[model samples]
Target chain A: MADAKPETKPKKTHQERMARKKQVIDERIAKATEERGVLILLKGNGKGKSSSAFGTMARCVGHGQKAAVIQFIKGRTETGEFKLFKDHPQIDWHVMGHGFTWETQDKTQDIAAAEKAWAQAEQLLQDDSLDMLVFDEMAYMFKYRYLELEPVLKALQNRPKNQHVIITGRVMPEGLLEIADTISDIRDERHAFRLGVKAQAGIEF
Target chain B: MADAKPETKPKKTHQERMARKKQVIDERIAKATEERGVLILLKGNGKGKSSSAFGTMARCVGHGQKAAVIQFIKGRTETGEFKLFKDHPQIDWHVMGHGFTWETQDKTQDIAAAEKAWAQAEQLLQDDSLDMLVFDEMAYMFKYRYLELEPVLKALQNRPKNQHVIITGRVMPEGLLEIADTISDIRDERHAFRLGVKAQAGIEF
Candidate 1:
């Protein structure tokens, strides 16, 4: 056979190179779906921590996953999240309207509300059927010393292995940090309020 | 005598009236200035959209506002956001990286890089001098197919009405939403090769 001369290879154009890169990326994505056991914490002074949590709840619902939420200090008013998820069959949503201690000032009532909220949280933590749980502003409970960290930690550790959890607040307790698989703190460097502005609907609130 | 009779009124405990109300609803801490225009957008799918946008190089150094960020995308990675802000002099921090993005093709790489860094994000977005801007995954982007929408319309039309702008993407591209805004898209999503599953970092470049 005639010597198979080495054929020169053609160089990939930028577009072609990008396409190849995308294909390879897609392949790797296929492999990442297998891993499990994830926890998330979103803390910050900026807006949207709770919004993000609710967004996750919506995603869980899309996936046909059973999800639950316990609002530690924002139960008083009707939140957009409550309106959206409360009626959804996939989510078990609960809110503790006690608000924050700085605003509430009554230590005794704060403790009582924390106890009541924690009782509901305990049940959610025990339910293996739940694919995800969100503790909205639960950090305030620990920050205010309204709830014992030990029990919360125990509940987190004891929850079903497959269940994922999310906690949102401005203050993150060290104990929660130690237990959290993921922690996000939101820092507010420049906020609109300093300029004497008001919070707009759907943006801040 | 009439004043004495009027004095015999019933006393109310502090908790009774406040019980039905929120101790603290959303409160605006500051306002935006005419010289600055900062707005934040937070909403769906893509990871680090908000983090990356707030990781502006110029603003973090210029302003001394105590900037911060709370990431919704969970998973650890040497985020661009971290390289600039984590140890910087004028920044505060927080993070929640618990391996989100439910549809993963490569589990190991995905989990390893799940924690989206927000160091730089805090430095720039939170600075009082820098003004406030948060890309809390502002939902308008995604709802509009990265091109068009209504929610974003209202956001742009009625933000705190001023200086800083932070936008996170998930398909929001309302009619010239960036009409008077600075806009940057993270562009990269669904990465697997970046983690060396195939594409690897730098080369997946």
Candidate 2:
């Protein structure tokens, strides 16, 4: 008993542990065989929801796929994403909002803008040639009652089966969440803005 | 008294309300004038931490700025980001891990790889020419105790004043969080993988 090895036991245990872990992961990977487009919802108060969408769009472009972006709440065309992607042959970009809600100062005008944006979005939804679509900050329309959710949901449901969509915003309606294939809720643990740091270019936008 | 103008009262009230809101936002935006590099930590269990970083990288690149990415946990060079950005004139990319931890199966080698990756990261931190640096999944090293937190913290503190850095992973050390100017916690509300959907290219990658 005194001569029994101690280090070997731990080594064997470690190997066994790793083997079990690998098997589980491998099985999961194997079990997941279906390939199709998915609906991804990025929600929360943190700062990367739009950035993540743009990053995915960039990834899709990397694969030579066509992509489109419809900015539902932003009125500015000078954003970093717009500057970079506006003229790219692989990307189709649109800025639909007139401006921030406060800036517009009229409920009727805001509704009109949202309706117009949705019209464009509906057209894109019907375009099967597009591989991906990013509905940046589109949830705000639903939150502010600028756009009806039912028709939007119906359009999403009937969109091209292989067309991926990434929707980003702080306020997500329940219907969108219900249909999402993946949802990432970005939480704000801390922010430099609270510390009086200016939102700078190439970062905040 | 019954003849008093009801609609006029509400319209005036709305204007006053908007005026107050505008003042507050204007003050905040005006107060935040200082600009410099920031450390952003993206944590929690969700997809898009890396995607956010990549998106930010694209934004930075859009501004004609330079970026470098040191992927601490990814071993594959065939990822969509790599294919799109590998030879990009503005990006410097490196994949420093042997693969997932279970795939490596050796703590010694894992630690060694982490150390090597950190060494590259440390060097990049000192280079002011690189406008941004992304330490993808580097948190796993600190979580596993493969890399000491103090040295990394010190390097970050002493790094170029104008260089922005983004660290993405689920496990974040307190020191990193403490120094981070922005922190995004990505929570997984739902995942397609759990529903037997395969992780597809240009989306999962």
The candidate maximizing TM-score is 2
* TM-score for chain A as predicted in candidate 1: 0.82
lDDT of 2 by residue, B100-169 (tens): 7788777888889999999999999999999999999999998878999999999999999989999999
Error of 1 at B87 (Å): 45
The clash count of every prediction, one per candidate, is 75, 0
Give candidate 1's whole-model lDDT: 0.54
Q: Model 1: which docking level applies?
A: incorrect
Candidate 2: misplaced stretches above 4 Å?
Answer: A1-13, B1-16
lDDT of 2 by residue, A96-133 (tens): 98776666767788889899999999999999999999
Candidate 1 stretches with Cα past 4 Å from truth are A1-12, A23-37, B1-38, B42-166, B169-205
Query: Candidate 2 at B51: error in angstroms?
Result: 0.4
CAPRI quality level assigned to candidate 2 from its DockQ score: medium
Model 1 chain B weakest 10-residue run by lDDT: B196-205
Give candidates' CA RMSD values in order. 16.9, 3.5
